[model samples]
Target: MKKGIVQVLCGEGRGKSACALGLAVKAAGSNKNIVVIQFLKGKNEETEIGRRLEPEIKVFSFEKSERPYCELSDEEKQEEAVNMRNGVNFAKKVLSTRDCDVLILDEILGLLDYGIIEPSDIQKLMEARDEDVDIIMTGIVFPEELNGCVDKISRIDTVDIKGV
Candidate 1:
């Protein structure tokens, strides 16, 4: 049985999401479907660049506030938790339905770090996808518990916060 490669791009680096989006663009150029579900980030405003992706690469962010999930007040965090879970449910739906050729769960690692979801959720998410559907996850921290399940793990730690 064949299965799609699961890749994780993680660490304190800045380009993780960019790398995922670049891959999505490549997939889109090849006439393939791509879906991006962004978490942790709370940017409610959609940029012009994001809008340009169009029906080719669908980007979804369920966050309400412009503040990061970690920055929210206790009450706000509670509210965003529900929204984030909805995003996870939507991701599961996309995977089960084979709605896209590539699924990019941006900042999903942070979801684990924040306890919004468990390794079991990730395991289940992985199980839910079709064999040929690639999954790319980007975040600052990659949980060690999932090390063996994924096909590839790219640690994207930054060398320096200041330019050399």
Candidate 2:
């Protein structure tokens, strides 16, 4: 049997989520089911397009505030912690259930940055996935702790900004 592929798109640049979404689209093109769970960053221009993907690509977010998590007050951050955990649990569910062939945990590595979850949690989730599925995670930070667990890591480094 083919083994599952665990990939991470991480760095201090833009387009990590965009690359994950591209992977989802490629999988869906092959009639594969996809589930995307977003964290930290709240909404963007692409959210509506993702929603339109529908049953083929189910997108979910557990963030309560409309604003990005980074912009929220401490009080709001405390409140959002629960929701983010729920998102993590749901990711585990998706893996255990084999609900989708492609699982995109957008900005999930940021969970580690905020002390929301541990590397062991991610290790466990990776272990629980079906051998045939593919998992893709994106974040601004590359998780050194997961270097051994992840099959591949692509660094997105920004060279320059288009505008000042």
Candidate 3:
């Protein structure tokens, strides 16, 4: 069977990365090469999962701050942009090899949301890849331009418990 295009998991609720990681696991089990680029900090669960995963999984982080776990400095922001570009570049290289069946740009939308990376660059990255390689994009926010490029989009809305 041929692979699917891009699937964007976005919104305010949690589990975006979790859902993406799950898909990666399934793909890896099927002997499909997979790469996951995480932008957010402290994805210990994912790291642990990747370690236990057989056939090995390509996962890496480009986090700015180890403390506060929420804020990012200007330098961190710059580093993130570089790392984001590098990840996409690496994916492009991998796509040329025709080895990988899936590539997950985890938290990519968040990078775009924070203006760490350009939307045009992302569009180009999608265009440069093989049509059969499946992509699972996870982030809290989705830009309008990106929304148009994606094949399917699923949003997770949040529920407020206490009304202050």
Q: Quick one: best TM-score, which candidate?
A: 2
Between prediction 1 and prediction 3, the one with superior lDDT is: 1
What is the Cα-based lDDT of residue 116 in candidate 2? Answer: 85
lDDT of each: 0.88, 0.88, 0.74
Task: Give the Å shift of residue 111 in candidate 3.
Answer: 1.2
- Determine the C-alpha RMSD for candidate 3 after optimal superposition of all C-alphas: 2.9
TM-score of each: 0.92, 0.93, 0.81
Which of the two, 1 or 3, has more TM-score?
A: 1
Q: After superposition, how far is residue 110 of candidate 3 from its true place, in Å?
A: 1.0
Per-residue C-alpha lDDT of model 2 across residues 47-81, encoded as one tens digit per residue: 66789989889999888677888898999988887
Candidate 1: RMSD over Cα atoms? 2.0
* Worst window of 10 by summed lDDT in candidate 2: 41-50
Candidate 3, residues 32-80: lDDT per residue as tens digits?
8887767655445665566565455688664434532245576765665
